[model samples]
Target: MSWVLGNLDVIGGHAGAHLLQALPAIVLAFVLALPVAKLAGRLGVLRGGISTAAALMYAIPSLPLFIVLPIVLGTSIRSMVNVIVALTLYGLALMVPAAIDAFRSVDGDVLRAATAQGYGPVARFWAVELPLAGPVLLAGLRVVVVSTVSLVTVGGVLGVPSLGMLFVDGFQRGITAEILAGIVLTAAIALALDGLLVLAGRALMPWASAGKAPAEPSPAGAPDPAAAAAGGAA
Candidate 1:
């Protein structure tokens, strides 16, 4: 408790830096993923190849990727750019499939109706398809945000600024408080980001929450005044 209180400034600063690294990567991944997803969905020949490449990139261990990225990109070993690039790759891996699935989940009949109503391809995609696909795409975004926040700690190993620095420092010096603070802070950040995304999704997709209206009362379920009148007459 005393350690955490003492290091509040350090923890907060690093947490801010952690978000700085993660949010941009997640945003970039979502933006870049749309086009990749569109191409993959439209081109059958490319779907498998694109998915496989994303999977392979994701499969590579984070630490090794961080170590190698500076060499490949010619950035400094401790460059935050390497961390951002690595995290962006991970976000892409997760988001591309989600985007493809979201787009595919739109009903064929609805699309046909949209086309028949004079909605051109681009117009349909923006006004109809994207709105309908919002729920699934937002779900993917939540996942990517949480995953990226957790992975940002790995950048600490490379001496990039983040909450992971606490972990590295704690482990080396055998300080339990620093380690616990890092773990708790990381979880808190992930949860906060996820909650914000959920709120954003709900705000943007009011229709999703507006479920079907109640059915009208059926004749069998309601008292039938005409039947009662006929029975009384009889």
Candidate 2:
């Protein structure tokens, strides 16, 4: 514990590096995903292809992705950039499918109503579709964030002193405290990011859960007029 407190700099640096490494991937992944989702929704082509590719990308060994980048891009390999690129590729692959699912989950009626009200594609997306889709999108993002938090440590194998690198170092040097620190930090970051995603989702789509279960019909064919009238009429 004393050692942990003493090495605040190391812990802080690792945390910052991890966040730096991940933020780009998360944002880029979502941005890339949104359009691919829209395109998939519009064209209805190769969705399985895109998702399978993402799953394949996920299955890919991260070390190899890092290795190929330096070989192909020729060794100007900034760990930050490599991590982001690797993350983005994996991110896009996973997220596009999730995004499409979220978008599809929105009420069809809401979209149709928006369409009837002279909302164009862009307007409708901004005004209606996105609003309804927010909860699902956030749920997927939370999954990605949690996954990325753990997977990101793999980036350290490439020489990024990312959070994972700490654990790697701890293992290499047989430092139990450092290894524990890394695990604890990673878990904390995952929880924090997931919480933020949930808050954002609630803010974006407050109405999605507003009408949880509709009122049941009266047992009689006609609602009781007295009861209905008292309750502001059926």
Candidate 3:
């Protein structure tokens, strides 16, 4: 506790560095996943191959990935780029399946209705499919957020600056407080990110908000006034 209290600036700098690595990974994975997922949803044959490859990519251990990515990327073993790229790959692995499910969950009937209303491919995708897919996509994104933040610590093993560095230093010096501080701050950052995502989802997709009171039953099904009005208009 005393060590953590005295090294506030050190902790803050590590946390900031941690976010820089994690956020870019999370965002890039999501952006890249959407197109891959859409393509997978459209083509049944490639979906299996993509899924298998993603699984294999994710199964690679983080520490080894940290050591190896530099060779592939032509960077130093301790480069932050290696950490970000590794995390991005992991994020994409998790997100692609989730995104595939999200798009598949949208109703075919709704899309047909959208087409009937003269919506072109791009407009329909942006206005209809994406909005309808928002809830499931958001769920996947939250998982990526937590996973990326936690995994940033793995880079510390390669001497990269992050909250994970606290773990390495604390273990070396036999200081439990520093390790505990790292664990607590990592969790707090994940929770904060998750809360913000939830709030943003609610703001952008108000229709998807949970826990709304059900509409009152129409007094023993008295012809459903709303349905009667629709019938008259038709």
Candidate 4:
């Protein structure tokens, strides 16, 4: 506790850096994933190939990838760019499939109706398809946000500035308070970001909250058709 109190500014700075790394990767991933997913959704032949490639990217061990990314991108190993690029790849790998699934999940009937109403491919996508896919797309965003937050901590292993540094420092000094503080703070940040995404999802899709009203019953003085039919049959 004393350690954390003493290092509050340091911890806050690291957390801010962690957000800086994560937020750009997340935003960029979503933007990139949308077009890829949309194309894959439209072209059946591309779906398997695209998904397999994303899966392969995701399957690579994060630490090794983090190390190799600097070499691949011609950046310094100590650079935050390495961490951002690595995390962005991961975000795209996860988000592409989610976006593809979201687009695929849109109702065929709605799509057909849109087409019948003379909506062109692009117009229908924005007006009909994208809006219908909102819930699932938001679900994917939540997953990406949480995953990115957690993964940013792993960058600390490579001396990248993040809350994960607390773990490294605490372990080196044998200070349990620093370790606990890092874990607690990381969890709190993840939860706060996840909650914000949920609220944003709700705000964007207000219709999702407006559930169907229950069917109304017949008027109290009205004759019961089911009972009348039953009595007639008897």
Candidate 5:
């Protein structure tokens, strides 16, 4: 705790920069993933290609990506941008597939009903599909957030002076406390974000099944005519 207090400046800077780097990727991936997911749902071609491409991005080792970016884009670019681009690319792989899965999990009957009611794509998405997909989106976002946290440390390895840099410094300096502080703090941040996503999903999709109903019929049965008819026939 004392060690963490001692490095408050460094820790805060790392947190701020990492957030800056991560926010853009999250927002960008989500916005772009929407259409891609929808299209993938509608046209089968996109599903394979998107999953493949995102997986390819994930396969690109971060160290190599760090090396390649400077050569292609050249240095003088901000560290934040580099982190954003890499994270965004990484996020696309996870987000696209997750979005597709979420969209697919949506009830087709509801979609057809919406279509019958003359709901357009955007309206239908907002009104019906997106709500139902909230849980899956949260699931994906949880993965993305955790991945971003881990990779920000990787970015620090490239002289990015991120949260990872703090760990690296602590390790190199043989300051066990600082290193421990970094690890604990990072885990806390990840847990906090993940919890928030879970809470938000629960709030947004209250209808999503979290548990089974109480193992009995409603105290006041709503009168099922089908059951009543069967009883009468007997």
Candidate 6:
């Protein structure tokens, strides 16, 4: 506790740097995932290939990717950009499959109804398809937010400024308090961001908060008593 109090400024700075690296990756991954998922939905032949590739991409160890990306992009191995890009790829790999499932989960009947109402492709997607997919997408987004925040700590191993630095430094000095502080702080940041995403989702999707209305019985296929009586009179 004394150590935390003494280095409050340092801790705060690291946390800020942590957020700066993480948040952008989360947003970029989501944006990229949507279009790729949409493409995969349209190109049935390509869906399997895309899923396989995303899985392979994610299976690549982060530390090695971090080392290799610098060569590909010509950035310093320790640069913040390198970390952010690596994190984005990891987030993207997770988000793509989840997003594909989200879009696929939308009912085809609803889309047909939207088309019957004279909705163009763009209008139907923006109004019906995207809104229907929102809940699942929100679930995936929450996962990405938590994962990204936690992953930022890995950058500290490479001498990038983040809470993970405490872990490295504490291990060398054998200060259990510092290590615990790092773990606790990293978890708190992840939870805080996740909570914010939940709030944002609720605000954007008020209908999801209101419990689903009871399913009304369908009138189709049931004989109409009035029609039967009219036929008998005729």
RMSD of each: 4.8, 3.0, 2.6, 5.4, 4.3, 4.8
Give the per-residue Cα lDDT of candidate 6 at 127: 95
Q: Which candidate achieves the best lDDT against the true structure?
A: 3
| Candidate 1 residue-wise lDDT, 1-234, digit = tens | 898899899999999999999999999999999899988989988887887887677898999999999999999988889999999999999999899888888898999999999999999999999888889999889999999999999999879999999999999998899999999999999999899988988899988999895675467887566677888999
Per-candidate Cα lDDT values, in order, are 0.91, 0.81, 0.93, 0.89, 0.79, 0.89
What TM-score number comes out for model 1? 0.90
Candidate 2 stretches greater than 4 Å from native: 213-234
Whole-model alpha-carbon lDDT for candidate 5: 0.79
Q: Indicate whether candidate 1 or candidate 3 has the larger lDDT.
A: 3
True-structure lDDT of candidate 1: 0.91
- Which ten-residue region of model 1 has the weakest summed lDDT? 214-223
What is the lDDT for 178 in model 6? 87
Clashing pairs in 4: none
Tell me which of candidates 1 and 3 scores higher on TM-score. 3
Off by over 4 Å in 6: 214-234
Ranking by TM-score, best first? 3, 1, 4, 6, 2, 5
Give the runs in model 3 whose Cα sits over 4 Å from its true position. Answer: 210-224, 227-234
Candidate 4 lDDT by residue in tens digits, 1-234: 888889899999999998889898999888999999988977898898898899688888999999998889999887889888988899999999999999989999999999999999999989999999999988998888888888988899899999888899889999999889888888888899999989988898999889996555464756577776888999
**TM-score, cand. 3 vs. native:** 0.91
Candidate 5 lDDT by residue in tens digits, 1-234: 687877799889887776677778877877788888888777886687876777677888888887677667766434567777778888887888888888888889998999999999889989988887877887888898888766777877677866777788888888888777767767777778778888877787778856776555443686566677888999
Give the alpha carbon lDDT tens digit for every residue of 1-234 in model 2: 776888899899989999987888898888788888877777666766766666677788878887788667565565577777888887876787789888889888878988998999889988888777777778778777887777788887666778887888888998888889999999999899988888776786678667676466675877866677888843
Local accuracy of candidate 6 as per-residue lDDT tens digits, 1-234 = 888899899889988889889989999999999999999999998998897788688888888888889999999987999989999999988899889989999999999999999999999999999999999999988899888888888888898888888898889999888899899999999999899989999999999889875555344755466676778999
Candidate topping TM-score = 3
